[model samples]
Target: MGGGEPGLGSAEVVQQPEQADAGSPAAGRLGLEPLPYVVGEDGAKQPVPGALSIFLRSGTAAAMCLDSLAAAQPGAPPFLRIPKEKLLADIQLQGAISDFHPIKDAIRAADCDALAVRPNLDDAYGDGNNYEVACSRAAAEAWQAVEEWRRAAAAEAEAAASAAAAQAALPKSKRRRAPQPWVDQGTEAEMEAVAGPPPRPPALLVLERPLRDLVASRQRHQRAQQQQQQPPQDQGKPASTQPQQQQQQQQQQQQQRAPRLVDVDASDLWSSAQSECRPFKDPNYDTRRARREAGAQAVPRLAEKGVQV
Candidate 1:
């Protein structure tokens, strides 16, 4: 009778139904799925493999790629809806929405034309495959960046280790330690001692109090007397012209203070060339010609006749 009623059923029957497979979409959609598991050696259920265990493995790389793509997108309340047609197309594609890890040359054949366009958050939030496609492109870029960084870090570490090994293989005499510049470790007191007590601060000289007071009083008295004497003369003159008169007086005083240039008779310049100036003589005409003539006269010419014995 309970089963016959329109919707009513036995409480036991309502409560219990054949459970769906844990990994199946139906189970996930209905919230009936247990946490993912695998059978262990003992036939006991074990938790599914972690990201780190599966990330590098070729077998699980596509799954990891999908997971990253999903994670890159906003989670569903308004569910992430990919159209059935687009889903079928993605399945037909070689690498689907995203290329798998250590992406092979074969995977490049898959039409990833969507990746060519920059991913936009607005498009990702729109209806249909836009969300998945944008997320896949973005996640792929992020994965590539991480992979490149990992490789670079690994290479640097390997190079450093090899360098260290090579250095260790060298003989002690051949090995050079990295140079360290000298750093001052002297304490303030030690430094002061080395510098000989800062030149005794030049022995500050303090003026006696009585002398300071006397000097200050004299200055004040002089200022008072000057001020008293200056006003009567100032009353006779216009205030504006006083500055001009003062400037003129200063100019005149400056002229008077200038050093005088005294005029005197200067002696004629003493020069060897001027003192020895006489009528110019040509040595060739005077000494050389005379010597040549005398030498010519002194030399006897040989006659046509034979010389006397």
Candidate 2:
């Protein structure tokens, strides 16, 4: 084939020969991966090499074709092991080949089912491809659950901090406790054994005198006083008998009464001189000689005027 551009009806335009410099691992695994073939105006298959670049840009049509070919031809080349149903979904979504009327005529002519195509994920983003790999449903759901749990944990921590702040804002209690006196274990045990304080003595027992003895002494004194204050009473009598009775009564009264102290008058001048009372002195006291003989003067009488004897 010449370097000149191929006619629109040639199948060789979409066929690719492998190139090590292309840097596609999938292409390296097999020969070169071809683009989709276009249809000519005469209902002939015409390969368009530009279809591969288009599939790489918009969707996974190249990967779908490679995977389907690998399934159909097990001995062919390396491709991703995607499920058959996923492959059909890729084929159905990728291009709707019927939209390209020329391609639709060519596919219908070959009796091909466009709905049965599948794609390999590796071929889409593997090697030099910069596309992000897609995750499965279960994996995505698990990541979402992890994110939710993390948020819940953060919320719980925030709630705990807020509750602590609120608790700290409350007023402290003002109640104070009475100081307890310290006691040794031995002393406390003894106190408990005794139960309470000792019993008190009775009031009667506490008195200095007996109750009966006090009452008897009080009654006797009252009777003696009453007898002394009263006057004597008598029946009618003769004069002599009355006089004798009166004399006897007088004698009895005189005997009962105590003698009164009387002082005799020493003013007769003939009476003998009475001795003066001596002053009392302490036996243990020592007196000075000058003070002991004080006031000891002799009495003197003057001589008579007519005779001096």
Candidate 3:
């Protein structure tokens, strides 16, 4: 016979025993006495030999045993020991060959070297009998992918949480208070009273021209007083009190005409000389100069101008 249909090979078919004469050795081995044989299906007297008889029993038993074994192996194809009777009944009633194919393929694909059957079934089939061996492999790979994704996501979340916790744990630095507007409005001496002594004044305020000039003038006066005590080298005539008094009056008049000093604190001055002062220009300078040269005593002078000084 040509190698029967793809799955129904010669090796798979159960062999029947031959009918023989009574008392023959084959009949004795079979534990049956072969008499006159009728070939028709209804009237046939079939004699099965011992080897074939054993094979048939073992084959049917194998199918039943597979079901129990398949249960033990979770990843196995789901069609191990499906009841042949039920399979036949389903085929007869439903005539669904597509359902039968997957079950058969699952069983055939199972590794014979495996220690136990693997009864992995597809979710598409409500009954475990419709097993999909390939689908089980695919599902396992998909599950692994899902597990890897979950692990990565969990690690990322842990790292993010740790970073947040670290940030929370750090001590916060104290913020400096903003400088008050009133603090900017005063002299160094006044601000010193408010702020208390240690820092001194800002450099700009401490080095102002007016305060610096006062310091220099005090030093010059001290030097002059020290020089006066030294003896003169040449003999000189004694000055007359009458001329000295007249000269003293002239000096007083000059002193009275000099510009009066206005007090400006260190805080109001700029740091550099260029920034501190600009040359003054009088708007009425030509007229004032002409009037003064003409010996005019009263030239209708402008009123005093008030400045921040």
Give the best candidate by lDDT.
2
CA deviation > 4 Å runs, candidate 1: 1-139, 179-189, 198-309
Model 1, residue 3: displacement in angstroms? Answer: 40
lDDT tens string, model 3, 28-52? 3433322211122343322111000
When 1 and 3 are scored with TM-score, the better candidate is: 1
Clashes of each: 0, 3, 6
Alpha-carbon lDDT of model 3: 0.36
The model with the greater TM-score, 2 or 3, is: 3
Candidate 3 off by > 4 Å: 1-103, 110-139, 155-240, 247-309
TM-score of each: 0.24, 0.17, 0.23
The whole-model lDDT of each prediction reads: 0.37, 0.38, 0.36
Total backbone collisions, model 2: 3
Position 163, candidate 1: lDDT = 74
lDDT of 2 by residue, 1-309 (tens): 011122333444333343222443333343343333334555454323222111223334354445444344544432233343453444456555511222332223322222222223333312232121112332223334433543444465576567667767766563333334454558657856886543653232222445555456555545545656767644666566887778867975784584532221233223234645444445522221222222323335466333212
Clashing residue pairs in candidate 2 are 64-118, 87-117, 87-118
